[model samples]
Target chain A: MEKVDCIIVGGGLAGLSAAYGLASEGLEVMVVERGDYSGAKNVTGGRLYLSPIRDIYPELWESAPFERPVTRELVTLMGDGASTTIELASDRFATAPHQSYTVLRARLDQWLADQVMEKGGMVITKNRVDEILMEGDKVIGIRAGGDDIGADVTIIAEGVLGLLSSKVGLREQPTARDHALGYKEILELPSSVIQDRWHLNEGEGAAHLFMGEVTKGMMGGGFLYTNKDSISLGIVVGMEAMRERTEKVESHTLLDAFKELPHIRPLVEGGTLVEYSAHAIPEGGIAKVPKLFGDGYLMVGDAAGLALNALLTVRGMDFAIASGFYAARAVADAKNRGDCSAAGLAQYEQSLRSSFVLKDLETAKEIPHIMENPRLFTHYPQAVSGLLEKLYTIGPHPSQKLSSTVIGGVRKDFMNARTLKELLAMRKI
Target chain B: MDIVVSVKTNLDLQMIRIKNREPVLEAIPYKTGDLDKNAVEAALQLRDAVGESKVIVLTVAESNRKVRETIKEVLAMGADEAVLIVDPALESTDQAGVARTLAAALQKIGSYDLVLFGEGSSDDYSGQVGPRVAELLGVPQIGYARQITAGGAGVLVERSMDEYIETLEAPLPAVLTVVSEINEPRIPSLMNIMKAGKKPTEEWSLADLGLDPAAVASSCETLSNLAEEQDRKHIMLEGGAAEQAAGLVNALLKEGIVGR
Candidate 1:
């Protein structure tokens, strides 16, 4: 049997990050993937945030198989028939050391996996690791395909829904409490139409977030992002929240509701859906993260419950990449010291904590509960939309001032004191 | 010269829908398991290569009777015989135990030049039964086969691996588990369906095989419940076509994909 310094169990962003980092240091690594290839099973919200990548892969945008760069961001507060949207554009994002770029996980991860192989790491696709091989409570290797592959250390980068972390007694069996399921569709549109619609130059893009009746009053939000000549559109809902609501809902039913929303309809009017998919995310925030270090093993990315700052918008890929980078660094350090024990691997957890991954996760832990309040997700968007409708409409009747329209909308949904509290509470969280 | 291909009716995953939080697999239509697809394809291919008189279809799920109707459909594809291995006690057996009962029937059939199976069943995905059956029958086995070609006193097969492929030859009467890409299965013609009715079908009961139900019953895995993951919700983007395009681009950027 060929022995390796490290074995990674997944081929997502985190796994690839670790692989790239370890291989760059000249360590023998193997990535066991369950997909047809690196990205066959990966689904993302369609962005690659740049802050994390600037230090590791500064010039990756030109070399990477990215779709486009986004220079605009839109937050839409929508109701049944009207919406108030805030669009923010930054010319500063247009230059290199770019702000953010859109990437297809399939293309990006495949490229990253190739780079790892290019650096002499072995990537084995179509193999599912069934169990972690242990020696007296220490993870020594992995068992897959009725064959055992021995390694000095193992990094469990398995995706969020994988049960292997719990199987080896490292993490508790996941519950609906800490997770949400997201369903996405990739629609194909002409590149010219995309640029014309989004008002972008050849390579620029924009992203939008929607609230209120689009979800039909559920506790989740919708998103749409532009690609080269296609769009990534989807909805993500809290699992526990959905369970509490007494509604018979299916993803397709919710999809139809989103499509028929007056504020959402024309955006995707003539596009053709090319791919439809469903995936789950760890939404339990910082509190639900499992044991990050154990006997000769470690978990990172979604498996470790390191998702993103939830209320700021769904962000996981960047966190996944950053976590993977740190995990690989730890493995490299442990190798340098010639110790692959749990104590040696604990460096990974420490470094991750000291890094932005943990600091941000810890701070944003309370955001989910704050966002869980239905009034914030519903009445806030409804109130904004109602106010906008009154301000924009030109009617034959006596016109009301914009201030009166805002006050009237707030009074319809909340009393003056309650409106102030809601705004303040939202700002504080 | 008769061939027996074992098949089971399983839940059609494509049509299965969850209503009231219960997976209605039974309510959904049934389809032949992946193994049976390869078995039928193998039988049809052999029938064309050797002669039609020697090909047969064998299944262990005859008690359902609906299963027999399915077997007829297989015969319609080209099998010269249709046999059903039916026994009330055989229901709900695990992979290892199912292999045991199958080994018993294969032994009673006496001898054959070859026996083929798909790499594994779809539901269990155990990928164990073929090798386990070969062990029981005292025959050499080759698995993960992407291509098979007849050879002297044995067969030559190409085993597909993750990156590399290997080809090996095993003696005649050996067992082989084939892969999906081996061949495109054929559909039964109208004439073949009419002819299948006249074909021979050997129906076997548990008593005929001299099997004790008590021995096999103990090996079955217990089933308590079946559940499915809940579906997600929809969050549509806003601001007409231009806004929608801008929204997508912005999401990608927020995801940290675009600029720096």
Candidate 2:
């Protein structure tokens, strides 16, 4: 039997990160993946928060196949035939370190996996781990294809469907309610066209978030992210909400509603669909984190339920990278001591709790409940869209000020007393 | 020439979540383990190289139901007959134990031209089994084979190593672990999926193999507790794009992916 310092499961962002970290420490590590390639089965909104990746792969931007750095952000409120947007643009993020960037997961994951292999780590792809090989209560190795591959420590970076995580007792049974499903389509558009339409520079990108009628009163949001030559557009809906309303609606209907939104139509007009992908995300927030470490093992990234504080933002990729870093640290420390056990690996949990991942998830736990209010997904966006439409439209009669129009629209959608209560509740939540 | 392809299923990590001090997982409805993609692909390639009529797909798992379904999919993708070892007691067996079980089954089946498997599975990711099973069966095994070719009763395979690749020539009935760097796996066609349903999936129980549970090695190592969490912080960039870009670049430099 061959023994390694550590074995990491899953070859996506988290597992690759752990492998990279462990290999950098001169420890022998092996990473196993079930996919044809690291990102073959992965699907995401396509935007990566730049901070965590920058911290782990500092000069990666120089040669990495990044789509583009985000230079503009748009928040839109949608109505039947009208929409209002809050646009923010700053020329600040164009240099070395970026605020955020976009990438196709398939390509980025493959590159990151290469980095792990380049650092003297072993990468075994298209392998599925069958079971955990144990010595008493301790995990000593993993079983695949009827053979045991021993390791001092095992880090599970398997993405959302962490089957082994639960089997190993790091996680329990996850219900659909604690998760969310997202379906996306990538639209091919020329660079110049994207630059002209989204008002971006040669290598810049834009991100747009849609709320209200797009989800059709469901508890979710829609997003559009510009890539090098394409746009990633998708909608994420709460699994529980989807289940609750399943009999009455279908995803295609919701998709059609989203596509029919006036502002969305023009943005995607004439674009050709190049790819379609769907994936499930763990949105259970901080309260949902499973056991992060146990005897001889640690969990990182989506396997540990690392998501951003708010569903509106891009978070998982950065969190996955960061957690993978910590898992590697814990394993390295354990390897130095020649020990891989529950107690020896406890530092992985401690380090993770101390990182920005747990804190963000904990903070964002309230956002979901706040978003549960019907008005947030229904009345509020409609009210804002109507007010914007009134502002932009010409009138022949004596003018009504923007303030009055906004007040009138707000009143039409919500009573003053109720609106005040909702605002207060939103603040408290 | 019949072929045996080993496949194993793993937890779908995409639906996995850490909740209430536990890692929660949901059972996958139906999908072969990712590595099996390579095995099926390799078999189809060999079949295409030789003849589809000669290739066979096989798997050994505690649960033959899923294995049978998976084999059918493999057949649809291009394989022939399939063999499944359906022993309930082997469900939680370790790698060595599984290897022994599969070897015993292979011995009973006898006369396989080639044996193929994925480098490792995604969930547990143990890369030892193919070689171990080969050891048990006393056959030459090739690890991390990115490309394989059958010629003159021997197989030519490109074995991918940490930093280099080696082309190895092995005799017939060799065990090969496929790497993702190999050819892309072909998706099963609609007609193939339908035809896979008709492929013969031979089921064998421990009783069929005349094996005793006590005879096999058993190591019950259980993973029961894991505690780690992620903390996310959104530091809204204070300055405009240029400032944020500089800060981002500095952060990247700290991470060490780029040169100063």
Candidate 3:
């Protein structure tokens, strides 16, 4: 049997971050990944908010492979044939330690795994960890390929599926309501074209999110993040709603409709589809988070359901990094005390409760429920677009007061007191 | 019996990106050649059958980060040890140069009873390395072996030659190239992967093997490498299902791709 100070069961951001932290402190750690490499199996909407992870690896962006610093943010509400957009751009976003950057997980995760190895950690790829070895209810190691390897501590950082965590009873199997299916395509274009289309300067990028009919009234949205020489565009739809969708409304059909939208087509015109991928996202928020730590074991990243979908910004990678960092700290503390028990490992949850990871999720816990309302996906965006159109159209004989036009549009949608209250609640997030 | 398997780290063709009709090869990720892994599996199988043998993996490539990762993968696949010849001068080495460098490393080790090579590399299908190495080492060589069995102090191999299969025997101390159908490679377990890091991997250069770089210079030179731009006529056949079917059949028949 082989022994290590720590065994990490996935090489995603969370696992690699924990491995990096443990290895940097002179702990022997091994990260076993089932993919050909760390990021080989990961997919994301392509923008990573780096503020939360700046402290994890202070110099991360200095050496990491980032597509571009995002200087522009655009959010659009799409109606049947029209849309309303809010665009924000700032020069401050282009500086070092910038707000966020666009990245392809395949390159970023591999770079992080390399960093872990360079920090004296070991990473083994193309190997699946079949099961966690236990000693009287304590996770002692992992069994992979019919071989038993022992470790002082084990961390499961598997992504949204959380297969290992569920198998080990850390959490129940996620249902359709708790997960979302995201399909993304990487479109190849010239760097100059991306800059021109997104109104970005050299080395600057944009993140654009689309709500409303882009999802074909499904409870989901479309996203586009600018890479250096390509565009990452995709749609994310809730599985609960997707399951109830008629067979004629397939997920790819939704993506195809989104691509043909008047506001989205010109941006991706003449681009080659280089790659397409689909992945599951854990959208269950803090309410669905499982028990984070146990005897000789810890769960981080999506395995712990540590993702937040705040409508304007959907984030997981940052949360994964933060959780990984906190989990490693707790594990290191436990090791220093020579206690690898459930009581000792409980500090991880404590750290998370006090940290931004859980706090942010707690604050946005209601966003998922609010987003689940079908009218929010179908009625609200169209009403808003109708109100804007009434305000903008300059017909010769119909010059009504702006307030009356707005009131008329709202009344047209049958926005009564209850609907107004619901809209207010939805806006609170 | 001791066996040495020669593997090559080639660019993952699937991951290759074509830009402006040119392949962006510099930063593309590389993996151990797919069929070369079969050769490694064959060598490991021979060792398993012989009961007391070692599988030494050998590769000649530039000493870079990508090559190091590739070498680790080969080691994890059950190679007892590895000999890596990573030198800047060999970055563009041709088949002949690679064969010479490998032959020199084998000669330096000096005790291998058999050597294994893939019939051809995935990136460059020049199936000359094994035979050229044998010629340089002055050893008998067998090419395109689909199945191999160990006999007394020797091995017998089954090979396909054009339209016929032939069985041949080679005494100890010979070279053999294997086809992809030889055997399925095994994925290393987590424990074995951990142990692979501790396995002895010795790095050598051309000078370390007491060979002059000038004598092993590449003979073949690549003039131009470009992605083949395929001009596809994406003509959409329209109308009802039966009409479209008849139109497709008519098109194929016009192109002589279907029955008359």
Candidate 4:
């Protein structure tokens, strides 16, 4: 078997980030990806919070093929008959150093791979890593197709499934209850039209989320993000919630139904459907995160379960990139110390623990349990929208005083003991 | 023995999209053309059979854009070396200019037992470069070669034709254009991909080829390359399921698609 300094099991953002980091420091690294290209098989609801990883690769982002800087945030609490959208625009978010940007993984990953190549790294696509090769459980390297290529350290960033790691017993098998399936469509609209529809200032973008009936209260939500000349509209549903439902629904049909909503219809009108993709997202939070480092291997990205979905601020890509950056730094340090053992590579996990990658996941530790309550996805959106609807309704009959109307709706919805219990639990979040 | 394969890089047509009856070329990745890969495979197999042979990939930059990565893809397929003929004058060059530049590079290499090429490029199926370069190099050429065999001083090739297969023998250092039937191109192993970038590659400009840039400049212009507008036949059959099935069969028979 031929050996290199490091082998990355996937050519996603995480693996490429690690490769870029290592190659810039003149290390021999190769990334194996199963997709025809770097991101040919990945999908995202797809916005990157750049602030978390702004300093990881400061040189790469300015010229990166980011679709648009996200400046506006909208969250729509949707009900069966009504919906309410709250839009927030901040000067800081719209400033030169924008906090986040909407992304299409195919474009972003390919461009990042190019940067990796520029720094002298090999991103071998169309090759699936079949096994994480083990020499007495030291994680020597990986076996792909017919080749067993050894490395001082192996980095597993094979997205959410973690098939290779799971098969080797390095990680636990993913469960339906711990994951969510996200389906997305890249719908193209004219650039001017996109700006006009999203109320953006030319290149600025918007990130919107819809809850409640969008997912039939299935502990999920619908998201719409504005791209340069397109919009990514998608729906996410908890796999367990989906499986337990009496009315079995195909994921695509959910997106279709969401799009048919009166509130959503006008937003996607006249848009050309360009791409459709569905992927499983790791929503297990920190509790389901597997072992980060062992022997000669380090797990990053979704393979390590380093994804956080804190409702309105769903995230994964930033954590993936950040973990990769830290992995590279740790690997470089390990090599410098003349040891590739578990003890030497311990810095990988330690760095992630200290960085925003793990810290944010820790802060959102109770999200998975909190999200399972179902009412967050169903009753709350309806309650909020229904109350607002009452407050704003006017007719031939004389309406009640505004204070009375507000108190009545509040008493009817929020005054219950269960509601109080739920509100009391909110402090954990 | 030493073999040189001329690979023409083209945009991955599968990734291209037709928008408003026009091909959107933005962000479409360039790759070693489809049949061009078959040419590389043939060259690799021949190099292995001939023993102690070198396979060098030769390419003329179709445009001034970066082709190093595209050429490296050929090297990953076991080409020992790469020679890229890149010049500002060749940016929009037509078939003749590319053939001339390829011949010039072959002359510079000046050491090979055989030269191979795809019958035609994936993007532009002109099928003229191999024969044209052979003419410019004053070498015997064979086209549409499906099977090639190495001999003492030359080679025997089985060429696929419209109605029948014809066998032809060409002397050493001849040019052969192969079809997709030749062989399947190997997906380079991880090691090969890792080493591809380190392979020896040379970049030659028009000056290096001893040709004046103005003389080798593109002699052709692409007026308009728009996608062909296809009109779907709006055929509707007003019938029940059984009648619709019978109607579909009858329509297919009328079109000679289901009849014996």
Give the Å shift of residue B186 in candidate 2.
18
Could you give candidate 2's per-residue lDDT for residues B1-260 as a string of tens digits?
Answer: 56788887565666555654677553233357787788778777787777743666656676754464466567777777777877777766778877887788788888787888889877778887889989988889999998888875588998999999899999977889998878788865333443465577688887788877654546866767664756664556668999999888777788786785
What order do you get sorting by lDDT, best first?
4, 3, 2, 1
Best by lDDT: 4
What fraction of the genuine interface contacts, i.e. the true contacts, does candidate 2 reproduce?
0.00
Better of 1 and 3 by lDDT: 3
* lDDT at A12, model 4: 93
- Top candidate by TM-score: 4
CA lDDT for candidate 4: 0.90
All candidates: DockQ: 0.01, 0.02, 0.57, 0.74
Choose 2 or 4, whichever is better by lDDT. Answer: 4
Q: Please list the residue runs of candidate 4 whose C-alpha ends up more than 4 Å from where it truly belongs after superposition.
A: B62-66, B232-260
Best by DockQ: 4
DockQ of 3: 0.57
Candidate 2 local accuracy as lDDT? 0.78
Ranking by TM-score: 4, 3, 1, 2
What clash pairs does model 3 have? none
- lDDT per residue for candidate 4 within B1-260, as digits (tens), equals 89999988888888989999889888887777888899999989988988899999998874434676677788988899999888777776788888888888899999988899999999889999999999999999999999999984599999999899999998988999999988988888889888999999888888898987766666777788888888865778877999999988988888789886
Instruction: Name the candidate, 2 or 4, with the larger TM-score value.
Output: 4
Candidate 1 structure quality by residue, lDDT tens digits, B20-51 = 46764532334567767776787567656665
